[model samples]
Target: MATALKTVQSSEAEEIAELVALSRAAQEQIAHYSQAQVDALIRAMVWAVAKPGVAEMIAQQTVDETQLGNYDGKYLKIFRKTRATLMDIIDDKSVGVIEEDPVRNIVKIAKPVGVIGALSPSTNPEATPVIKAISAVKGRNSIIVAPHPRAKLTNKLICDLMRAAIVKMGAPADIVLSIDIPSVEKTNELMRQCDRVLATGGSAMVTAAYSSGTPALGVGVGNAVITVDETADLDDAAEKIRLSKTLDLAASCSSDNAVILVDAIYDEMLAKLVGKGGLVLDDDQKAKLQGAIWVDGHINAKVVAQTPKFIGDYAGFAVPEGTQFFIVHETGAGPDHPFSGEKMTVTMAVYRAKDLDHAIDLTNRIQAYQGQGHSCGIYSRSDANIMKLAEATRTSRVMVNQPQSASNSGNLWNGMRQTFSLGCGSWGGNGTNNNITWRDLINETWVSKPLAVAKTLPSDEVLFGDVIAKLG
Candidate 1:
């Protein structure tokens, strides 16, 4: 048995190695592609899946295969998000000679990072792979995707579609590849062999990516918390929260897992939320929900990304006919309270704060225990309060009076770069704080020329006068 297991492991490693080599060969073939050629290939890949019938089919197939998220959400993400990503990088230069600095007499050239190993999560598999493919090819690189087991077939379908598009565009089909049969060992091997790893999944996978000894860009776990102050439009805030929490049944990491209500408007805001298809659970129901949402200290897989009715029934609680989400009252945060963490379902916890300061404290406390450095949002007409929350909380993005899920990952309403991966910086144990995009898939070389005219350097008095005065 031991020998057989060893043989199986060796075979898997060999298979991954072959995929890596194929990807490397394909990447080299495109090393000479001009900016226009690369852009055309990107357009081809985007149109292949973003077209009318194709997007719907992929969305339906993703829901059927993964048994998570809704078809409508998946479809919009597949079609609109893909095109939106294209729009985001439409005029951006990722090829040779991408930038020039006249003052510094420097020319910056972009080069491909070779093959990338991308680990996509099942929750957003349909769109994540498409986005990653576009980003990789934008830099004239190849990518091999290792998807979650539940979304392997969906991943393969998306990869194959993109590969065909590339082939039709006169590019190598091997530029986009997938591990049709994904395993822990196979994914590990791929990460180890690839030039860089783009890991976008759970904590374990991201941790593994960082540990693979290869350069990697991984995202942090998300437990997005939103704060609503007395100055906020209660009705509008409630409506946006309803839309975000119920969208795709809370499949997105940016979905509001917990909401903090200011004491001045806590009652009114809770009432408003209740009016918007939110069912505030009683103590009994809250107890039942805690048990249902978690099993043995882990989120219950069955409840994840499920409809409110399904989660209610599973938890043995009464869900009203039009109920779109469930709200449980909680006062504390930490491992002892499971609701303070990420609940990937149509359920959220509601907290009451004395004021904006308390709200920020609660937000920091909760995130520190679980989602530190991911993201948080606020619904406040008071700019002071909004800025206060933004400065106080150790989070990446702060959505102001907008839907957290729709706004955090680059929505049309915001200026954020469209992306499937959100970096959490050192706070979340990731490298960058920017939305991971094509800009991250390439390396740059700076060519410097002798300056025709030299500029005077700053004197110590000018540079350090303020610091020196403070010291004195």
Candidate 2:
């Protein structure tokens, strides 16, 4: 009986391995689709988005299962994924044939990466998958998603719905796959084996993707800082800061973890902030929120989106009955200051600066202490000040007069492509991946032959005045 049981277990393991292999092989085949097929895939993805409440359901499931963010905020992210990301790709010329110059006789084309292995985060679980899946469709590639262990259920459900949509829309059934059981070992194996990898979330996973010997797009960790100068409208700035810090309980990558305020407006800003639901805690409340924020030098995952009252209770903060958000006022920037780093929660740190220049300097110091290349926010109407801060801060993205989370993700008044991930160029003093987009996932190769003999040089008379003028 023992021998028979062992044989059965071995056979089951072999079958599982075969299924994975077959799935990968099918993916390889789908990756070679014609442009028309790619368009069909995109259409299917759009159709999936069009399904009533599909996006909402995915977001709701993620929040319910993970307990990391609020449903309403996740709903907005999902809406963005469907409308901003998915629909935007419909008109984008990522795939198919393109004619650049008829005169020069140069044509460029897009080709799919063979197989993509995407690592999704626990936060924004649904949006991550939708983004990567749409990119795959745009590039005519097959994607296999390895969701974070904390988000397996949500990931599985989203993948299932997406697959159904694709099949219903006449695309291959196995173009997108999700591993039901995701482990570090399994994810590492997938990263090693896949043709291209896109990893988002914690630094550890991004590091693993970079070292996996596969072409990879890895996002850097974000600890976004926002600065409010004396020139800023105190009330407007305070309201926007409050909204940005508490949105989705501050689970966003671009959420304002630290606020640097000019001393001239510090008191007024604090007053307005407090009036707009910001909780200024006592020493005991500060200690409680601090404990709830960190665990063994890392941000605590469990307390990320919980109410301040709940976190305060857990941290043993003796406070009034009702508390919404926790605030910590600190003198300097560093690990010693918990708010200086990304809290992934509703907690924010307030730092008073001597002046506008000092606010920028202090903001730079805070980012340098941790988030050098991620992003920064400033609420200012002065173009010079905006340009000055944009130039001085080493971050890849700068948001002016708006919530950092929305602006950094490409929803700013200025036109910028929407993306959940921001690349910190070398300035964040990190690797160059300034922004995550479909174009980054697909590598381009110019298939061109040198024009034979430069198409006959212009006539001497035509060349003399025209060519000389052009040369000048």
Give the per-residue lDDT digits (tens) of candidate 2, residues 1-472: 9999778656545543544565567666666676667767766765575356777777778888888878877887776645676655567787656447666667777777767888889887877887888777678777888898989998898788778888886776677888888778678777877778888878888888889998877777788888888788878888788778777777787888888888888888888888877788777667777887788998887788776766766787654654446678877877877678778888888888887788778878787777778888898878898999888877788888888876787763656667776778765434554567777667576667787767678677776977767787
* lDDT (CA) per prediction: 0.93, 0.76
Give the worst 10-residue stretch by lDDT in candidate 2: 11-20
Assess candidate 1 and give its TM-score to the true structure.
Answer: 0.97
Candidate 2, after superposition: displacement of residue 247 in Å?
1.7
Q: Give candidate 1's whole-model lDDT.
A: 0.93
Candidate 1: Cα lDDT at 385: 90
Clashes of each: 0, 5
Best by lDDT: 1
